[model samples]
Target: MPPSSAQARADTADELVTALDSLESLTSTDPERALASATEVEHRANLIGREDLTMRAQLVRGYALDRLGEVSSGGRIAHEVNRWATEHGHQALLARSHLQLSWFFNMIGDTPAQLEHALRGLECLDEHAPARIRADHLQTLAGALITNGSHEEARTRFQMAEDLAMQGGDVHLQIKVLNNRAFGEYVAGNAQAAMDTADRMLALAATHDFPLEITALDTVASAQMALGRHAEAERTLLSAAERSVGSRGANGEPEAQILLTLAETQRLLGATDRARTTLVRCMDACEEGGLAGVRVGALREQAELLAMEGNYRDAYELHKVFHAESEALVSAERDARARTLQAVFETDEARRESLRFREMSMRDPLTGLYNRRFVDERLDAMLGEWTASGSPFSIALVDLDHFKQVNDAFSHAMGDEVLKKVAEILTSAVTEPAFAARLGGEEFLLVMPDTSRQEAVFCCEAVGLLLRSHDWSTLIGEISITASFGVTSATASRGSRSALLAEADRNLYAAKRAGRDRAISDPTSER
Candidate 1:
């Protein structure tokens, strides 16, 4: 006998609710059961031609598939849902579908697709949704933009999302948006700003009772680690990890991000064994949850830890996989950048050619001196070489005394000539094969490849005297300039690049303190 219409409608609604409840439960603790429930719902919904029910069922199924590491298949389903929602004028559903699809693409390292979906979701929300949906969409879009290397724009979007969320009284969304903005700031080399933002988010998270609180604390810890606040990072991460253990069975992205933060903080604190163990645990959690992207991130962190511990063979094998992932992400970013530049330049070939020239122009035009970009690249290479060769090098930081006074007394053009002359004089003073770079303004760096403390000191002193002795022909009269030099030699046992720079800067300050035209060398300090 056929079922009555009222009974059929009731049955369908009851079944959908049951499936959704089961799926939500499994999303945190048992994905297999959730997947089974989702599959049944999907079948029933399709038979009944209920679009909303079908979409919800598909969403749950896609999420389960993603957890099971079937990312491509899951992403296809998400895309289909997104397209269907758009075609049917389901604005809210369409926005959510695009947001989920963006995350799906991000899992596979398809940054362009991620950004496209995020932007589309944002557009949908702006055009037809409420403030809450708009804020959520903006947060997702900001995260995608940050991942794709659009730091400045991502920051603005994140801020706007946070403000909107706060105005709408959505503390959860505000915390999430703040965390997203902090990550962008960290990557953009603004560690202090990142730390500040993370602290604010953590405080806000604490006032709210939500799962996102744990995630926000983890972000705070990561920011603290980046800013060299290791003790604070350890404390924050420990608290987050402890809270997260209760929810570890969940297959949520936040859990993975928190675990990765804990592992990274451990690694930064030189607890290599602990870090490796934590990373392995994170990988296990990711696999269990069927979170493929998180698993990939855990793998990359494990590889880095192995590399740090001198397990190069194992690290290299892991890095091979990491390289493949990185290349995919980089290719997407390059394509996006290319498109953006093409819009600016009009011609594709011209844009490509201009990018090539811009890369080469990273070096200083005057004095044939390496610029800041070259210095950063060379420092990385130098560290690698030193690790292999066990050779010592010395770095001398030179600053001209009262440089602004020279420009004020003479014409600005003449000041440029004086700087050029000073560069030439310094270059001529160093007899050994060394690297000289202009570090912006009147600051310069000279790196002696294989020099001892005494030799480096002598070379720096000679350069200081050369600058003091050079006479500049100005319209008013001939003038002489003096420079202060600080010399710090690199040792095989030095901590890091930043440490070396700090030591050299300290000695340079000492030189200036002693006198305006003197050289200071500190060979006893091993900083």
Candidate 2:
């Protein structure tokens, strides 16, 4: 007798989930295959009506598309998933979506947007989150932080990510994190640190019986050269090539990188003929690996070789080709960033999920800023600290300036757009130790822990200026918008939550009465 229908359906569900896992596994090593598998898994999940699985499948598909050079479509998919995940309270999907968006931003060289998304992704991971997923997002955030010039923070994030990866026994993730950390250190001029990190990556791969990480080797060679170890660098490259077992690398491009680095090492070591020969091999590896970026480097290397050989004419010609390729690569990615988001998905599940998510939200649904409930909870603890230890802190009550004329003239939707923009400015202004929250409507509060009254006042003023000078027409057609702030610092008597806010509120009212678009901090006049 055939299997029962119920059993068959259960098996099918499990199979689809398993397929999704396989697709995700192939994402980095073989994106083309991952894309195909993702499509198939998506169909299977949809057929079975597993909304979560479908969302996961779509996210993986977007990642594969991005790796395969379809940035616009992938970004659209990612954004749609993000919106849906946010509505559903699906933290896993939300985290992945932000990670994908960060990737899109990084590809286009939008460091600020990349950093923003990376931070959001890291925020979404909780204790129950899978270790591998947590490590992936954390590692990505570390890279973004480093690129944004926060090396110390980046190092801490990297260490955390690597520790997580090691705990999970994910050898590949460990290698990847170590390699990236090393390269980031090298770029930041920490040569010894880079070498140590690269060495650790190699050690991890060797102990795990995994293929040699060509990228780590390349990083090691670069760090060696940076430390003036010319001969050592050459030896490292040779060992990497031999371990790689020909031109093909763990990934195609890394071998080309190794070859180019070797050629550069030779050139620096005064071996002109050897460098020229190595350059030819580099060009061959580049073509084989479809490494256009590395090919450009090879061309520049060839040009330098010719220049060294007293052939300035040929050298200059090759340099022109290299320059053109370089310019085109940069221009192409920026142009791709201009492709607007064009994805939409609507279902009763999504609609219902939004209402559910909103009910549980600690953050405002519209601006994604923390809501009053979250602020109240945090302030309760903060007040206890202030009452116990007299720990200094400050709060700024912010209110947007308007007479409801703009809302009536331009419609409430446009007014909402203006609010969101203000929220963005406020959100960006707050650093790690400080936070901004939406109390309700156009009212917000900035809480600064361990900050002086003067510092809080300065912060509010800067935010006010940003809002005042912002060209609102870009968001709403030709309009001026500003904000007023009331700042107050924490003290023993003011530790009472109501009293603290009332102080800020009085100052806020004073600012509104005097003139909008200004910050008021009355450290002198107090109860």
- Identify the leading candidate in terms of lDDT: 2
lDDT (Cα, tens digit) per residue for candidate 1, span 28-68:
34566778888888888877778787887887787777666
Clashing residue pairs in candidate 2 are none
After best superposition, candidate 2 residue 127: deviation in angstroms?
2.3
TM-scores for all candidates: the values are 0.49, 0.61
lDDT of 2 by residue, 187-303 (tens): 889999998888888788778888755666788899999988989999989888776655462345666777788998998898998898888877887777677788888988888
Relative to the true structure, candidate 1 reaches a TM of 0.49
| Candidate 1 structure lDDT | 0.73
Which lDDT values do the candidates have, in the order given? 0.73, 0.81
* Collision count of model 2: 0
Query: Which segments of candidate 2 are over 4 A away from where they belong?
Result: 1-11, 238-255, 284-292, 310-329, 339-527
